[model samples]
Target: MAYKKETMESDCIKAILDNNLMFQEDIFSFVGFARSTYFDRSLDKSDAIKKALNDNRIKTKHTLKKKWEKSDNPTLQIALYKLICDDHEFNRLAGVKNDITSGGEPFDIEVFIVNGKNKTKKKD
Candidate 1:
């Protein structure tokens, strides 16, 4: 039997959106298609399926961003900061330890925790 695009397209879209599937192989597997069929049918090139997958992924990202924004979790806030902030700002906020010296010697370290303020400690 051959795979029918007309019959499988809707199922593919539904599975993608329902499962929040982001990978082509996962989507094809969820829809019960062989890997060879996926390539032979050019399912990767199908605009409808591609659009559905991209849209679903973007929608999922937006939902997660919203949740992260609305919550008061500092970990998530720091994670979001890491995504948007420059290396300097992120290091300032999350703290960075330079544990190796230019001379290849162990260096003192300062660890910062996001518990409302920054704290520092020296490595023993």
Candidate 2:
């Protein structure tokens, strides 16, 4: 049995919004549509489906940001930081020592590098 385009599109949109899915496979799986059929019908190329996924992703990010801001949980804070902070900031806050020297001895190097930047390392 073949499904109507409208039915398939609506089902895919609902699956995306409801499941907060951002990937094509997850959306098609949740909606019980075959990946090949989805691609063949160009349902994967639908602008509506793309917009729904992007919008839902933005909404989820905003929700998570708000929750992270108000909560004092260290895990949540770290998770959000990992999501938003650059590699340098994350390493600094997490106490990740990216020491390139093989031994414990401090060598006289002209430039100190952290996350690809050559400057004085900030005290965490």
The TM-score measured for candidate 1 stands at: 0.62
Report the lDDT tens digits of candidate 1 across residue range 45-112: 98988998888788888888888888899988767777888867877876785445757676778976
Query: For residues 1-124, could you state the per-residue lDDT of candidate 2 as single tens digits?
Result: 6978888999999998888898777876687768787887889889999999889888988998999978899989888888889878978988886876669677777965567855588799
lDDT of 1 at 72: 100
Candidates in order, TM-scores: namely: 0.62, 0.58
**What lDDT would candidate 1 get against the real structure?**
0.79
Candidate 2 lDDT for residue 69: 77
- Point out where model 1 deviates above 4 Å: 86-124
Predicted structure with the largest lDDT when compared to the true one: 2
Best by TM-score: 1
lDDT of each: 0.79, 0.84
